[model samples]
Target: MADTEFVIEPGRQDLVMIRMFDAPPDVVFRAITDPELIPRWWGPHVLTTRVDRMEVRPGGRWRYVNVDAHGREWAFSGVYHAVVPPERYVRTWEFEGAPEEVALETVTLTEVDGRTRYVAQSVHPSVEARDAIVRADGPRGGRESMDRLAVLLGTVADM
Candidate 1:
């Protein structure tokens, strides 16, 4: 890919954005940072993800332990940079699998037509890094997670 490919925005922030859900703002926010809820939707549809920790407050830490289809385990972790209740959050992320990688993530929640409009913005050290992540987890894994989150919200809706 070209450098312009991952030039998501003209600033140091808002490098990547993806939206794919129909839940409420609060519910979507919780699904992104809550430890108990992450495990249910934070992986490729074919893999099982396990959450070791997810502390949603500033300076807190979160860890993801994922198991591939063949029962392989990989870990990822990060510390929260900023945590704005029901609206915004920023964090530093690192994946402990393959050649290690790190990125900064910022998420904002908005209300669209009375439903949640969740946007996830991820920034990497460089465009090269961004392309690498896309190659690794692309083909809409994030979209799949968002889909899973919608399902989770549906499950909660009826309860």
Candidate 2:
């Protein structure tokens, strides 16, 4: 149970998130791509997440919604561009609330000494759109999600 730390770097038109997990690359990859496991760690603790549709393959479409305690839902949808099992994945992300804003995201996982380093790079349409995501607490939520993912991986390991 080491401290789960994530580095978030924001650029003019992109954001990069780096995190280390005490697990293998395959485990980390499954936690992210598996619809069953996604709800366990995809969002902050205060919200409940559900993956309505998940097809992890090229040209596949996916959608998930997060519901707050008050039952308000925040939905997100995306299209998969590439899926490299246990290593890399590329997709487009869009929040239903902000239909015009979209980001192309690439997630790469590397393993070293039984630990995996997870990196997610997101390129937005513009700097303003990128900054807006950060200002909206995207980093905070991402960090929380990683923390939860770490815990979930630990629990899964024991099972």
The residue-by-residue lDDT of candidate 2 on 72-123, one tens digit each, is: 9999999999999899999999989998998999999999789998889989
Using TM-score, give the best candidate's number. Answer: 2
| TM-score of structure candidate 1 | 0.83
| Candidate 2 residue runs with Cα over 4 Å from true position | 1-11
| Tens digits of per-residue lDDT for model 1, 68-107 | 8788887888999999978889998877764345788888
lDDT of 1: 0.73
In terms of lDDT, the poorest run of 10 residues in model 1 is 1-10
Instruction: For model 2, state the Cα shift of residue 128 in Å.
Output: 0.2
lDDT of each: 0.73, 0.89
What local lDDT score does residue 135 receive in model 2, on the 0 to 100 scale? 87
